[model samples]
Target chain A: MKSFGSIRRNFAPWKDPAAKPYIEFRNVTKIFGDFTAVDNLSLNIYEREFFALLGASGCGKSTLLRMLAGFEEPTSGAILLDGQDLRGIPPYRRPVNMMFQSYALFPHMTVEANIAFGLKQDGMPKPDIEARVKEMLKLVRLEQFAKRKPHQLSGGQRQRVALARSVAKRPKVLLLDEPLGALDKKLREATQFELMDLQQDLGLTFVVVTHDQEEAMTMADRIAIMDKGQVMQVATPAEVYEAPSSRFVADFVGNVNMLEGEVASRDENRVVITGASGAQITVEHSGDVQPGTHVAFAIRPEKIKVSSKQPVGTGANAMQGEVWDLAYLGDMTVYHIKLDDGQVVKASSLNSARIHDDPLTWSDRAWISFTPDAGVVLTR
Target chain B: MQGKLSRFNIVSLVFGFAFLYLPIVLLVIYSFNASRLVTVWGGFSTRWYVSLFSNQQLIDAAWVTFRIAVISATVATVLGTMAALALTRYTRFRGRFLFSGMVFAPLVMPEVITGLSLLLLFVAIGLDRGMFTVTLAHVTFSMCFVAVVVQSRLLSFDRSLEEAAMDLGATPTRTFFHVTLPVIMPAIVSGWMLAFTLSLDDLVIASFTSGPGATTLPMRIYSQVRLGVTPEINAVCTLLIAFVTVGVLTAAIVNKRRDLQRQRDEHAALRG
Candidate 1:
């Protein structure tokens, strides 16, 4: 196994405490008057990782990104980049670039000139800046429009130019604030992959801050879910989705159906839950709890099995129900089944074809059950 | 139907122009009148224009005014552009609001009060009042308006472009020069033009601040008009009006080009 020290050496960007991590936020906090915009937070971003800080509005995700870019200094805590502390370093000094939500392309500059700005600032020879700017423009598929001003380009073209400009200097890190948030749904989707491709192509540490859960799930290798200036959970999308650390994580990440109940039985392999709503359900349980204690169980909508008529099975984990509602998505159909005790639980069934050989529509009495592994016990 | 309405719009526009520009026409017409009485026209003659060209004193004063206006306008533009960048780019900065109020104060101030206060300031500083003092005062006054003009341009500018430049490995100073300055160049030009006009037409502030032997063209004209209207003075006024017209036209052309560029950028922004 590679030690942490060896890993740092392997990734040269993390070599010094100056480069221990590509970027580090150590106990950082920012306050605006009486309101604390960012509370005590420490984060480490490794080299070449497409990390995302996902949260709802006013969640301080953008604030954290700004601190890294040196636009807004943290009131307390230290920001270190390439292992060096970013105390007195201004935005220009840091080897970091940012793509604003507005793109902020200079209107007066042609596509080539806008992309060449940072190179010029580096005092690179004129010929070299031109060559690099042209190369970057071609990377973003903007070579043909080099002579056109920002106003002359389309939004997507302008975005590419902005991208070209930032990447031209090859900063160590790229900070994107809702990169595709302004585009229409289709365009946004297309741009998302293009952005990912670009990030991978450059192999730069990219920190994307966004509120859209799907976008975070699709792009980031690691996701940090923030709420009220604190990170609730940080994990890969699969882990965060499969076993959320808390109820907030479960609800925020995806569609989850929850059941409140008490633990009637417990064992190493599985546990039986006697729901407060008068339904007995068994789930694969791995948590800290006592048998007499009250608890909640969570199941993904697509996890449960649905069948017409009562099953020829007798157990504490099965329930008789009637279909209350149905929702038809293009790929699957969701059935909202009301249990005998009046708890409406949702279950999704795939629709592979236009015709349904077995349809569970409204008012159809049915039996619903799931393998213990399908649902997990959530204590918080 | 759209064409006919557009034609009607054109006719009304002509009438509007006639009403607005007829006074200028009268000013030029009377400058050529043979009679001394401005309201009465005796005959068409070149006497006023001939006398105006022959006046050495008026020419010297005009040259002095031009020098002061050009230098002050250029100085004011540099300072104003810096102020505009500071104001628009940084949010929640210390002393920002105070700085903004100070920049805007001179615009609404009456010329008389400004003149008096400046004159007192000069006296307090133990500085002699003359072309130097007048140029200093004009730059001080012109800078505020220039800041305001440039600041508006900065407000409408896309700040992201500068960030992009920084990301590309340019220093903040480089990003500003390469990205920010080029973006707001039109506003800088327009601000310079505005300052130049204000300095060229100034009378009240220059009157209080100026010392002996450094009289500006406006000050000289004021003294000449006081002695009763002369064809020479009339000719000078007419020539000044022509210069102002040309300056305004040039400023408008530059402004229109900037406006078109801004609109194109906005449309592009909406799409990509």
Candidate 2:
């Protein structure tokens, strides 16, 4: 089995305490009239990191990004880019570029002109600007589409042009607001990997704001889940998925079976709880918690095992249930097991074989079981 | 159902077009008459048209009117586009509402009242009433029309394009010139055309503001019409109508060709 530390081998600057942050937001708060868009938020982003701010709409992720790009000023506190305060700098003078969600390519300019716009603004020599534009076009793999206007290009091609235009100047940091939000599903999936490779190739710090959790999980080195103008959690994808800090993070990231319970007993690394539905739940937790404290035991569906016959020698983590529903996905089968106490538990098993000789069907008596280390105990 | 036109529809169509164009058609046909009288058509001839070219007074008036229209339209387009940019880009400022109300007030005011007010203001300022004052008065009223035309286009403009330009390291002034100006060029051109047409045939305002030397075409035509109508006057009016028709047709053809090109580009993009 692959462990958490092994998955991310060397590129973890955030883990080193001595490493200085490339960008820092210090107690920033932005209030528009009565509505507070960002409320006393602080964050640190490392150099060359592909960071994602993931949240639902109106969660202030875009506002945070705009603030970093110098389009917005924080009502209080300061933002520092490489130790320099970015409070009064205009967007034109800032060494950061943004790829807008609308992919705001100049409709009047051809593809080559659009990509050359930024380099020309810096007053580069004519030959240098032409060479840089050619390099950008080749980087985005649009060699034959230099003369096409934005309207003459396809949506995906326009997206690439927008990307190439923003990065042609090679800013210190690139801010992407919903970069893949405009692409279709298949195209978005393909572009996600391309963006990852490009980020590695350019070696620039990237800050992406997206509402899609799957996109964040696929591309970000670290994901910051935001809610109501506050950062709920910031961690690597594996840590966020396997060990969410709260019930909100657990439910927001993926599907989880959260059993509401109170702590009945505790040991060094194991905590047993009596659920509200009268089922005994045991999970591995090293945190300090008193007995009788209410908590939630969160487990993902794929962590639990469902079988027709009850497994032998299983204790508090095993429960008898009936198969209430099942979904036969091409690569896996998900069973919704209704326990005897009327709580529905979801368990997914991979469909490794082509056919099942004795498959558990609807209303069939089944057993759902998991080990103590499979789930986490959330205090909030 | 598609090819057949009902009798009621055909009758209404004929009546609508006739109501709009019958007088103009009569004027055009009478311009070609060999008779000196406009109402009597004594067969077709180009004699009146030939005589129109030699009428030095009418030619001078036409020249003055053309100069005023071109100068006033160009000035109004520049000022009105600036006003539109200010109104749309800055949504909140002290007295923004009052400023916008004053800018659009001339649009709804009666032309006679506007002309009278402009005449009073020019006289009060000790400014001579001549080609300059007349151009100034036309610009005052026609620029409001230009503002309204450009304001509607600015409201629907995507502001992110400007922001993108700024983010790409261009200054605000450069962004406006390179991005905003080009994107809004069509609206600005149309606004200029509208102002030009408004200034071209204006009679009341021009009469109020013109001095002894600057007699415009509309003022001359109105004075000549008081006497017996002549085929020479009809010929002049016909030429004016032909100029306007050609202008309108060229604009329409240009717009249609642009739209067709856009459609073809979109189709090619879709196929790819």
Candidate 3:
């Protein structure tokens, strides 16, 4: 937790998008004895982007970050930062910094001293180091606790101090290792916004590693979902959640009601599939297959429309389901409906604009419907 | 952190304390007996205590033991700390397994075996059996104890503190002294204390390695006890126990105080 909390300010002296990528992992692989931590990973991160490496524990996201920070030497593959290969670079010598999940601030040093550490390492003048330390304290809003040791500070405060310390050095790329995993739920939510604001203001390239889907979805510009030492999907959070490229990404992101469907017809933009309930449904995505191909169509729970009775003139994509379970989440209600074919579909309806006569409830016969574009047909 | 206990536990705890301390209590009581023979106690007298203060040979042996303990303890602490750091901080190396085995070999091997081996080693190296050789042998095993104690402390430690210091601009060496060393100072001090105690209590190794003029207090006491159980030896044992008890109590008190402070901090963190 002490190794993360770094922000990389715009540092190349000149801004040129046509140039090379900020940080590149060119076919990197890490092996510890017989256990392989990371496979041949090749990834390119642009400048000023909030990229997330999303995965479960031991999926090589941490290993990749360690390689970038010069903690682990890649067994094969070259890691490059700012056009130079990080072949012999040690952690302390690297221009990149990491914020550990543990918020690894020095317990003996005050907040200011902790922040001033990297600056002093670079042999900056005392006055300049002081000024920068003050600025970092103000940025993290710990000006009052500048003299406070890490143990004297709260977890959230220590997190900010680590962040401040990391930013004080102002490296080219900042690596965050489960940055928000240590905070309480409420503080984590609030700090997510603060971090986004800080990142936007600094316009730094940030690579955050986390297992928390909510945190990654709320913050990252693009996320590379990893599984078993490989990247499963690399896309924006919206695209990843709304249109997962695979079954793994779909299940990993959020709750989705997957229906077993057979391809019945196809168009350039749309494919019609006959579901297990003998209902025709249309889904939109790239790639096309012939009729009778086994395809899986996924729809998020909130995208489904539920009503007590079927409308007279319905187009397509309609099924009758009996309410199996209801989870009222205050702001919205999630309904788990079991279709006639025994396929369970989940739907969520908001409590916004309060209406008393809603027909969706426990043990109620309901017609669940969705638009053609509501669900995405996962390829592979 | 709470030590959960019930009435039965308290009772058993009292019983356990009696079982452990009953022997020491009897020993202390017999140390005060003024009888010429150990089986009979004629009366309580201060002759043994007076004899201990006046015996120059015993005093010289005690001085030699003290010197050996101080030097060996200091050497063991420094070297043992480096060994601990090498084992814990660095990734596995080719010789790591061998080094670890050698360091901890003393704890499991027989004392007589260790004493005999060191005697052969010193003789082969053309080293005379004296305080120097005794210090070397004492340090070799005492360092093992120091390394284990220090290594446990390092295990419970958070390594990020060192990385943070290094990130702040300190070299790896500087970070060790300025940040890492200060944090682990309590463990290091305790390791040194443990090593010192081991060296001070050592008799077999010192006896095997001693030369013409370097008879340690333990060696002298062993010879005296073989001849007969003298109150003089009891007086010395009593003094050694007193010194050791005071030293151990001071260390435990200091550790407990730090533990309480750490608990308070954790409580405050939880509150926040």
List all candidate RMSDs to the true structure. Answer: 5.0, 1.5, 5.4
Q: How many backbone clashes does candidate 3 have?
A: 15
The sequence of per-residue lDDT tens digits that candidate 3 reaches over residues A1-380 is: 32112323333322356767878889888998898888888888877888899999989999999888877899999999878999987788888888988888877777888888788778899999999998998999988888767887788988898888887888877889899999999999999999899988887889999999999988887789998888888877777888788888898889988777899988887788897768887776558688888888888998898778884554447789899999988899888888888888889988886666765778989888887778788656
The residue ranges of model 2 lying beyond 4 angstroms of the native Cα positions read A5-9, A313-316, B1-4
Supply every candidate's count of residue pairs whose N, Cα or C atoms clash at under 3 angstroms: 15, 0, 15
Q: What is the DockQ of each candidate?
A: 0.45, 0.88, 0.42
On residues A305-375, what C-alpha lDDT tens digit does candidate 1 reach at each position?
78895556544256888999988888988899999888899898787679868777789998888767776
Clashing pairs in 2: none
Q: Write the per-residue lDDT of candidate 3 for residues B1-272, one digit (tens) a residue.
A: 25898888989999999999987876677678788676678789878888889999999999999999999999999999999988887756888888888989889888889899999999998998899999999998899899998999999899866765665557788888878898888788989888888888899888888898999999999998999988787888888889999988987898899789878876776675
TM-score for predicted model 3 compared with the true structure: 0.87
CA-lDDT, candidates in order: 0.83, 0.93, 0.84
Worst 10 residues of 1 chain A by lDDT: A2-11
User: Which candidate's TM-score is highest?
Assistant: 2
Q: What local lDDT score does residue A304 receive in model 1, on the 0 to 100 scale? A: 74
Model 2 per-residue lDDT tens digits across residues B32-55: 999877787799999988999999
Best lDDT goes to which candidate?
2
Interface RMSD of each: 3.8, 0.6, 2.4
Off-target runs (Cα >4 Å) in candidate 1 are: A1-23, A80-83, A125-127, A312-317, B1-22, B35-37, B82-100, B123-126, B157-159, B257-272
lDDT of 2 by residue, A1-380 (tens): 64453354368888899999999999999998898999899999999999999999999999999999888899998999999999999999999999999999999999999999999899999999999999999999999999999999898999999999999999999999999999999999999999999999999999999999999999999999999999999999888999899999999998999999999999998899998776777788999999999999999999998888877765437889899999999899999999998999989999999988899999999999998888899998
What is the CA-based DockQ of model 1?
Answer: 0.45
